[model samples]
Target: MSQANPDRPDLDLSSCDKEPIRFPGSIQPHGFLLALSPTLQVLQASDNLDDMIGADAARAIGQSLQAVIGEQAGLQLVPEIDAADIGQRPLYLCTLGIGPARHFDVLAHYYDALLILEFESVARASAADFRHLHRQVGDFLLKLTDTASTRTMSALAAQEIRRVTGFGRVMVYQFDDEGHGHVLAECRADDYPSYLGQRFPASDIPRQARELYMLNRIRLIQDADYTPARLVPALNPVTGKPNDLSFAALRSVSPIHLQYMRNMGTLASMSVSLMVKGKLWGLISCHHATPCTVAFDKRTACEQLGQILSMCIESREDANELQFRLDVRRIMVSMLAGLTQSADFIDNLSSVFPALLKFARAGGAAILFEERLLTYGDTPDEEAIRELVAWLDLHCHGDVFHTDQLAALYPPAAALAANSAGLLAMPVSRIHKHYLLWFRPEVVRTVEWAGNPHDKDGAPPAAQLTPRTSFATWRETITGTSAPWHGGEIELAIEFRSALLGIALERAEQMAELAEELGRANKELEAFSYSVSHDLRAPLRHIVGFSDLLLEPSANENLEKRQRFLRNIKDSARLAGKLVDDLLSFSQMGRAALRPTLIQMDDLVRSCIDKLALDIGARQVEWDIGTLPAMRADPTFVQLALYNLLSNAVKFTSQKERAVITIRASDEGAEWVMSIADNGAGFHMDYVHKLFGVFQRLHRMEDFQGTGIGLANVRRIIERHGGRVWAKGAPGNGATFYFSIPKELNI
Candidate 1:
C-alpha cells in the first residue's frame, strides 16, 4: 500500500471487496498531517515534518501544538477548533506562513476524538482568480437548476468541472444497481485517448473505497508516483491503534490504486463524489496527462458542484419515476382492452395476472397466493411449483426472492430446468403467505467482458495486487441460467404486485359487505318461508288426499268431481314446485362467485325473448324493443333477471286486447337505465316499494297466478351488480319498471 495501514487482519483477502482502504495510517507526501488530542496536544505527526516544520516528527510528538507551530498560528487554531463542528467534513481553517514565501492552507477535522490537521502547500494566486471561480460556480448552478434531465446535467457537470480544474480529461459516469460503471459524459483533450463508452467492473473500485467516497465526499492524488509519508508514532496514543485518516485530505492511497492510475497514464487525478440520498450515485472524476495540482479553493468549488448535482440528480430521477408510473397505468388499460377483445382472454388468464408477464419478460408466471398455485404460459408442473414455493416460504426473509440459477439454490428445481431455471417472487400480502412469481427458461449465451470475467471477483490476480492491463475483448459461453433481471423489471414487478394487492383487498371488503347483507336477507327469508309453509300446508294435504281418492274405485263414482279434485291437486303441486325452485335459486345466488364479462345487453335481451317463446306463444303481444348499449356483467344472472321482467310484462299485459310492452334502454350518467313498461294492470305508486319483496303480491292470486318471487330475484341480481331497481305506476294506468346497471364497475 502507498500508505502503511494496519488494516483489519481478519479481512478475507480472497475478495477485493474486503480491503480496508479507509484505514490507511500514513498521509500523502506532498502534504503533512498531524494528529492531536482534543485539547490541542500533539499525539502523532508525519515523518516528513522535518523539512516542512524544521523539526523531527518524533521530537514534535508529545509536545504542545502551540510550541510546534508558531504562537500566532497556534492562537488561530484554538478559536477555529472551538467554533468548528467536529461532525462535519474537513473544514479549511486558515492559511499559515512559516516564512515570507512558505505558506500552507490548514484544514482541520475531528476523527475518533482526535483533531486531524492537514497542511497543504498554497500556491500564489491573484484575487481575480478567486472571483472568476465564484462566477463560474454561480453560472454552473443556474444552468444546473434549468437543466431538465440527469443526462443533460451530467454533461453540464463534466464540462464545468473540466473548465474549473483545467484537467486534460473529465468524465462523469454513473453506477448501475449491479455496481458496473459506465462513462456517461466526457470532456477531454484532443490528444488524450478516449475512454468513452468504456465499462468498468465493480472490482475496480472495491467495496470499502466506495464507502469512503461516500463518507469523505472528495479525494485528491497530487502525484500518483509520489512516496508516502510515515507516521512518527505508528499508533495513536489515545486509542492505541493506527489513526483513522478517513476524513484526511492528505491521506495516502493504496499502492494498487496508484499502480492502476499509472497504468491509465494519469499522473494526477481528483474525484468528487456525487451522492443522492446518502448513496454514492456517481463521480466527477478528473484526470491530467501531466502532473498538476488544483488550488484548494478550486477543488472546493468542484465539491460544491458535486453537491448541487446530487440534488439535481434526485429531482430528475423522481420526475422520471412519476412519468414511468403514468406510462404503466396507460399500458395497463390498453393491454386490458386488447385481452378482453380477444376470443379467449378469460380462458388464458384462468390462472393468474398473465398480462404482467409482458413486463417480466419471462417464459411464464405463477401465483402462490391464498394457498392456490396457478400457472400460466410455459411453466413447471404443479408439484415442482409447490416445492419451490415451500422452499421460498421457509428460507426467504425479504419482500422478494430472486435467482437466475434456481438449481444452485434449490436442487429439486434442476429437474424443472426447462422453464423454471430462473424465478422472481414478490409478496402480494405482507401479513399473509401470498406471493406472485415469474419464471424464465434456461438460456445459453455469450458474456463479453473488457478483461478476464473470472477476475471480476475483486481478488488479486496473483500474490501481489495488480490491475488487468489488457483492453482486449473477452468472451465466454454461459449456460444453465436465465438472463439476469434488471432494476427496471423489478420495479415494474413491485408496481404490479401493489396493484394486485390493492384490488384483492378491495374485493375482500366488497365480499365482506355482501356477506353481511346476505346474512340479514337469509334471516328474513327464513321467517318468510315459515309463513309460506303455514299458508300452503292445508292445500298440500288436500292434494295428497285427492290423489289417493282418485286411485280408489269408490271415490271415482262421480267422474266430474274426480276430475275437479285432480285439477286442484295439479294446480297446487305446480305452484309448490315453482316456489321451491325459485327459493333454491335465490339462496344460491349470494354464495356463488360472479364470473363477469363484457356483455351486449341487446343480444342478451333478444336471447331472453327467444327463451320466453313458449310463454308468448299465440299471444297478441306487441313488443317494441329499443336499442341497448354494450356493458360488462354476469351474463347468466343478468339473463335470468331479463327473463323474469319480460315474463311479468307478458302476464300483466295479457288483459290488454293488444298488449303493448315497450322495452327501452337509456344512458343515465353513472348507470344504464332500462325500462319495461306495459299497458297492463298497473298498481298505485304508493305500493311501488313492495314490488321487489318476496311473495308480496299486490293483486289477488286469481287475478295473476304468480309467486311474486321473480321481481325479488331481479332486485337481488341488479343490486349484486352494483345497481338499483325501482318502479313508477298509477292505479289502472300503466306501470314502468326500471332497473339500472352501473356503466363502469370494478366488480
Candidate 2:
C-alpha cells in the first residue's frame, strides 16, 4: 500500500505496464505455483504447496519462492524461464516419492508452480473415502433431509467432481419427490454432448436398475455389453421363496440394457450412486467416447474418490444452509429494528428473495395436505408443501417397495422402478412432515434416463418403455423429466425458502404495525390543518373587515387622507390572505402522490395562455408557442409551473411596446426540457437565489403582483419529478425559465 504524503503528487503506478516472467519446458510436472512482484517478493502461492513445502507450506507461503526452494535449484531453474514461456511453459519436472507416505510430481513454471499430487489407500478399510462420498451422499441426504439453499454448494460440488474424475462430463442426478429423475449439471466434455438443457424420460432406467445403484454405490460397467454380468439366486435372504434382485449388486445382465447403451453410441459408462438413508437419491454418471474398462483396483479408487467428493459437497451444502439461515436472520433483525408493520412487509416480501434465485420458476408448492399454485416469492411455500403430508402419511404397505407404487399417480411411473417403480410413496417421516414440496417442470436428463441408444441388440426387453408420441415426448425422454423438481433447483428453493421464511413473516408483522402508525399520523395532520384554517382566518378577517369599516366614513374634510390609510390597510390584508393560501398549497404538495398523465405540451401551453388571457389582452402582449412533444407528468402541477413563468415574462416586460413570451419544448432522450423565454426586465444574476423562495421577492410590491411563492412552487413541482430548474440571464438581458421532467420515474 502507498502511504499518503502531502509533498508528493498522487501518481498511480498500478497500470499493466510490466512484462511477466515465463518458463520454458515440455511435459510440465506440477509444482508449488507462486506469483512474484518485480522485486521477487512472493505475492501468491498455489494450493498444491502442502505437497512440496512440507507441513509448514501454508505458514511460509508469503516468503520469497526463490529463497524457500534454495539457491542451487533457483539458479538452475532461473535461466530456463523467459517472458515467452507463460501459462503453459514449464521448467524442471520430476515425479519423486517423499518418504514412504505418498508420490508427487513437481513442475516449475514461470507463470505459476504446478504440482500433481496423488494418494493411495486400501479398498476394504475405505471408511475415509466412504465418508467423503457419504458427505456427498449426505449432501444428497441434506437435499432430502433439510430445506436449504444449495446453489452455491451444488456449483461447488459439480466443480469438485469435474476436477477429481478428469472425466469429460459429470452431473448430479436427482429424483423428485414424485420419484422422477433429472440432470443437474452436464459439466461439458471435449465436444461435450448437447445433453445440457435437454430433458429425458423417467422410464429410461427401470426400477430394478435404480435399486441396484443404491446398494452398489458405484456401477462401473466400462462397456455395458462387455462387462461381465453378476448373477445371483432369486431366493430371498429372509424367505425361502424367489424374490426380486433389483436392489442387489449381483443381478443377472439384462440384454436390452446393453443394446440400449450401444444404441446411444456410449462406449463406456461409470456412475456413483447418491443415496439418503439407504433410499436412492441420485447418481453421478461419467461417460466415455471410446470403449474402456476400469480395472478392479482403479474402479475401487474411483469409487473412493467419488465418495470423498460427495461428502465434501454435502459438508459445503450444510455450511451454506447455516449461512442462509444467518442471512435471513440478519434481514429480519434489520426490519424489526425499524418497527415496520406486518402488512407492509408482506406487500414487499417478494423483494427479499435474492435476485439470483428465479423464484418464479417454481410452478407449484405443497404444504401438509394443501397444494397451492405459486406466483414467485409469495408467502413461504412451507404451508403449501405441508398440504401433501397426508399422502406420505404411512410407509409402503408391503415390506418390498418400488417404482410400481408411483404408476397409479405419476406420469411414466415406470421410471421409479428402482425400488419398485413408485413402490416407495413419499414417506411420512419427520423430515417429510417438516419439509417443503416444490414442483417444477423437469428440463434436463436424469442419471438412468439414457436416450435412444440407436441400437437394440444389447438392450433388455423389460427395460423398454413405450415409444414417445410427440417431439416433446422425445425431448423429455432424452433429457429426463422429474416433475421439474431437480435436486439442485429444489435445493435452491429450499435454501431460499428457509432463509426468507422467517424474515418474510416478520416483515408482514412489521408492515401491519407501520400501517397503524401512518393512519395515526394522517389523523394528526388533519387536526393540525383544521386548527390552522380557523386560527389564521380569524385575524385576516379582522384586518379586512376593519379597513372596510373605516372606508364608510367619507364626509370629513380630511377624507382623502383617511381614504389613503384605508387603502393601505386593505392592501396589506389582501397580501396576507394570498400568502396564507400559498403556504397551504406548499404544505399540501408533500401529501400528493405522483399521478403521471400524458400531457401535450401544446395543450399545456395553451391552457396557461388562456388563464393569463385577460392580463395579456389588457397589456397587449404577444406570445410565441413552438412545436412541443407530448410528455407524462402531473398535468395540474405542470400547468401551474408553466403559468408562473409566462406570467413573470409578461410582468417583467410590461415596459416594452411589444412584450413577447415564447414557450418551447425539446425532448432529451429520457426527459422533456421546456423553456419559457421573455423580453423582460431581468434582474441581476447575483440575486437568483431569491427567485424561487417563499416570501422572497426581487421587486417591490407596488410593481409586481406576486406573493413570492409562484417560482417556489414551480421549482418544487419540477424537483418532485426528478427534474431540475434554473434561470439563465443578465441584468439587462431577458430571462429564460427552464425546467426538465423525466420521461420515466426513477423508482
Candidate 3:
C-alpha cells in the first residue's frame, strides 16, 4: 500500500484520481520506483522496497544503487540510467531476479532533476517470444493495409489486437464533436459482455488524461486489484515534488479509475491512442477478464497499427471529399444555367432553392432579397425568419456564416432550435444584403453513458473527481443540436457561394449593358420626335394655306367643286397634325423621369374629371366613385393616366342618354389596382387588343373622333411606374380598363 504524505493528508483518493495522475508520487504494488541523483546514489525509493528487492526503503536512500540491488544487477541498469535524457523516452534494462514472484523488467529515465528507474514483474514467459510475435504482427499489418475504409480497418485492427493481446474483448472507439466516444468496431470472446454500441462520456477520461494519451500512445493497467506503492520520500528529493511519470510504463493507475474497472469486472486494461495528423482521434481499447500484461514490444506493435489505421482514415476521407466537390460543382452548373435563363433573377431562385436543400441535405432554406423573403421546405414563420435574418446581419462578418449549434451561439435562436439548430448562410450580394440560408433541424438523441453523469445526492462545491462506481447503462436525451457539418460540407458551401457570386456578377454586367442600350434608344427617339414636329408640320400647313387661297371667291371657277376641294384640304391637314402631336406625346412619355410621392387616388381621379368637364359640357353623365387607396407614384403620370381613361369613357358613351362611369381601387398584396367602367359604343373583344396601339382607331371618324393614342399613352405611363394595364370590351357593351401599380418602387 502507498504511504500518504503528512503535508497532503487532505488529498483524498476521489479528488486525487480526478486531477492529473501523470505526476503521482506512487507506483503500483507490482512495481518499484526509485529516484537517484546524477551520481547514481539512491535519493528516494518506493516504501515497499523490501518487498520488491529485499532492501529496506529508508536504508536504501543516500546509498549507491549498486549497494541496494547488488553489483551485477546494478551494472545492468547503470548504462541505461547514465544514457537517459530528460524528456526523452525511458530506456529498457534487462530483466532481473530468478522466479516468477521475483523476476522484474527494469526501465530508467532522467526527468525533473533526478534519475528515475521503475521495475515491474515479468508476467508470462511468452512475452519474450518476439520471433513469433513479430511474424503475427507483420501478417496483421498486411491485412490492415489491404483495407481502405476506416470502418473496415478498425474491424480488422480490433480482431487482431484481441488475438495478439489475449484480451477477452477489444473495441475500436471513435470520438464525436463533444469528446464522447462510441464503439465503432469490437471483437470479443463468447463469455465476455459486448460494449459494441455503448457510448462513454467526456468525463470518463478527464482533460489531463487525454493530454497524456497524446504524449504517450500506449498505457497498460496490469491488475486493477493490486495495491499501490508509495515513493520513500513521497516526493522527488531533488525537485521536492512528485516525479513526472508521464512516460513511465509502471505508473500507478488512479484509484477511482481502478474502482471503475473493478465495477466493470475488468481485471486488466490496455489502450493505444489512434492519432491522425497529430491529433488524438480515438483509441483501441483491450480489456481482459483476468490479470494480463502486454509485453513492451507487443504494445509498440499495436501503436504502429493505430498509426497505420489513422493514415487509412485520412486517405479515405480525402477521396470522399474530392467526389463530393465534383458533385457540388455539377449541381452548381445546373442551378446557374436556370438562373441565367430566367427573366428575373430573384424570382428564379424559388425553383433553385429546392435544389439547394437537396444538395446540402438540409431540412429547410430561405432567401432574403431586400424586404422580400421566400422560403422552401420546412421553415419557421415569416416573422421569425425575418428576426433571424436581422440577427445574422448584425453578427455575420465574412461572406459565409455557419454553425452546427446555432442555439449555443445565439441565445434568441434557442427557442428556434427545434427547427433551425444548424444554419449555413451566404450573403450573395453585399450591397443589397441578400442572403441564402440553409437550415438543419435539431437532433434529439439518446446518449448511452456508462453511468448517471450528474451527482444525484446533492451539489458539491469541489469538483467531483471520482469516477462513478456503476456500470449500469444510463440514457440521456440530448437536445438543441444537430449533426455537425463536416469539413467537406463547409468547403462545398464556400465553393457554391463563389460560383453563385460569379453568376450574379455576370447578370449585373448584362443588366448594365441593357440599361446603356435603353438610354441610347431614348436619346434617338427624342431627336426623331424633334425633327418630326418641325419638318412634318410645314407641309400640312402649306397645303391648308394654298387650299384656302384657292377657295377665295375670285379664284373659284365652280362653286360645288371649290367647296369640296377646300373641305378635303382642311380634313387632310387636321388628320396629319393630330398624328404628329400624338407621336410627340408618346416620345415624351418614354423620356420623362418619374418623381414619386404619396397621393390620394380619390383626389387624383376627381382632379382628372374636373379637367375633362369642358368636353362633358351638356352631356348627362352619372358617376359612381368608391373609396380609393392612397398610393406612392408620380402624381403627374397618374393624373394623365386617369384623364386618358376617363376621357375615353366619356367619348365612347356620347350616344347614351345617361352615361354611367364607375371608378374604384382595390389592394392586391404588393400593388394597388384601379379600374374605370363605362356604358358606351365599345369595340368588339377581337379588336380590344388593337385599341391600345397608336393610331389604331376602331370606330369611324363620323361616329367618334379620336387619335387612338390615348389608351397607348395610358399603357406607357402605368408601365413606367412598374405597373400593368389590361382592358376587356365587346361591341355595344361597356368596357372596363384596369391598371395596377406597385405599392413601392425604387424611383
C-alpha lDDT score of every prediction, in listed order: 0.75, 0.49, 0.76
Candidate 3: residue pairs that collide:
none
Instruction: Give stretches of model 1 more than 4 Å off.
Output: 1-18, 71-88, 125-133, 145-147, 333-450, 453-464, 471-747
For candidate 3, the 10 contiguous residues with the lowest summed lDDT are 1-10
Better of 1 and 3 by TM-score: 3
Each model's TM-score? 0.57, 0.29, 0.64
Candidate 3 contains a number of clashing pairs equal to 0
List where candidate 3 sits over 4 angstroms from the true fold. Answer: 1-8, 12-18, 79-87, 98-101, 123-129, 145-148, 405-419, 455-465, 513-747
lDDT of 3 by residue, 1-747 (tens): 133333235555444424547866677777787778878899988888888778899999999989988887777667755664545466666566633357677767766787777777776532244466567657866886533577778899998888778899999998877788888899999998777777887778877888999988888998988777777887777777777778888777666678768878898999999886678889999998789987666776777777777777766664565467568657766876777667676787887887888777789999898678899988778898888877887667465788888988888788888789998888765334578888999999887766666752243635455445666677889899877776656755665665565455445445645664577555544645554454446557866676777657864555446545655554655555455445545545765578899999999888778867879999999999999999999887788789889999999999999999999889899999999999998778887777776556789867998766788788889989889899888788889999999988855
Winning model by TM-score: 3
Give per-residue lDDT, candidate 3, residue 57.
95
* Residue range 440-497, candidate 2, lDDT tens digits: 3324433333443332234454422323222222322323233322233333333334
- Model 1 scores what on Cα lDDT? 0.75
Q: Which segments of candidate 2 are over 4 A away from where they belong?
A: 1-194, 226-251, 276-279, 288-291, 338-747
